[model samples]
Each structure stands twice: as C-alpha cells, then as structure tokens.
Target: MDLSVTGDPVLAQDETEVHAGIYLQKGTLTLTRKGKDFVAYHALVMFASANATPWAAQRVKFTATGPDSKAVEVTVDLLNDSWDGPRAGIAEAIWKVVALAATAAGDIGITYAPPGRT
Candidate 1:
C-alpha cells in the first residue's frame, strides 16, 4: 500500500475571503494489494478549513480503481463535529478517518484504527 499527498496550487477564492491562506489542496492515498498490485484503490481528500466554518470534517472522497482502468468514487460525509479542544486536532482526526476508510475499502490486509480506539 502506498500513500501520498497531491496539492493544488490554486487557492479557493471564496474561502480565501475568510481564511486568507487556505488552498483547495488535495491529497491522494492509494492502496494496492501485495500480490495483485495492479488493481489499486485510491482515496482522494480535499480538506476545507474550519477557520471559516465550525465543521469537523470538511470534505473527503474515496476512489476505487479496477483492472480495466475504470474508477468509482464515493463522497464521504463525516458527522463528528463536537470538537472543542484545539484547531490543530481537527487535521489529525480528518487524516485518521481518511486512512481508516481507505484501508477498509481496499482490504489492504493491515488493520487500521484511530490512535486511541480500535
């Protein structure tokens, strides 16, 4: 399994009004089975800043790629918006969800859970 982040250079125009430095950045996390590596599944993530809104999960996307090069994508709606700790913790939670979803869908052999939970 391989994971990587891809960034979009363009900043979100509307979001920049509230959060000046926010970019419409994108990240791609790919999972491939060890023996059958050709069939890869990907999770494409776009994070929206809570600097503008009070939401926990901004946005997330999961993509699956088959051998025929056909791709299917699902948009995930995360509803864990009760965070009152710190702004920095939001990124960690978002990433953990991304990993758990990607690995669960791809069936990549490894068990993944958030830091404190199973």
Candidate 2:
C-alpha cells in the first residue's frame, strides 16, 4: 500500500481503517497493535452473576491521551446500542473503536478473565 500525503486539508474520519501505509496522525500513532502507544483503553465490563443489562445503555468507554499527555474519555455506541442478553452462552464480545483523531489513536489491547481467574 503506497501512501502519499494527500494535499487535501481535511481531517480523516474516525471510521477510516488504518491499513498499511495509510495516512495517520503524524508523530502520533502506529500502524500495528500490541505494545502500542497507549492512546486509549476500552474498559469492558462483565457482570459475574447477572442476567440482564446493567444500566440500559452500555456504551464502550475509553480514555485516550494525546501528545500533550492529557487524557480524554471517548465513548462509542454499540451495534444496537444495547446488550441485554444472558452471559451463559455468550461466546465472546467484540468492540471496535474508530479513528479517534487523537494525538495518538491506537487500538487498545483487550483480554477477558471470565468470572473467576487470576
């Protein structure tokens, strides 16, 4: 993927996928994940013994930091904006954060520990 800085003076949208050589916020984020510059985090919450939605609207909340070292919390909506299903047969949960346009917007690594595990 050959990338050339576009002369267009418009900011890229958050939905822009970060492909190889794709233009990203210069001097900010990287093109890969893992050990990435901690730009933000999505604190996935899972109830231990619950059978319904915790509050009603479960939004993915994450905090991103810019070059200035200031953190800003960014909340993204879910597919249907609701998760009122049970947790017994749920295989896994997946969430995606778009191009945040932060000083450095990188995908935060996510891991699940079930209900009982250290």
Name model 2 segments beyond 4 Å from true: 1-38, 42-57, 79-118
Candidate 2 residues 1-118, lDDT tens each?
9988866674443322222112223334322224445354333331122233121212344455644566655444432423443234222331212222221232322122322221
Residue 89 Cα positional deviation in candidate 2, in Å, after optimal superposition: 24
TM-score for candidate 1, please give it: 0.30
Per-candidate TM vs. native? Answer: 0.30, 0.27
The lDDT per prediction is 0.41, 0.32
lDDT of 2 at 111: 27
Compose the digit string of candidate 1's lDDT tens values, residues 3-102.
9979877534334112011212233434344443232244444333344442223346555564566765545444354533223433464556545543
lDDT of 2: 0.32
Give residue 43's error in model 2 in angstroms.
Answer: 2.3
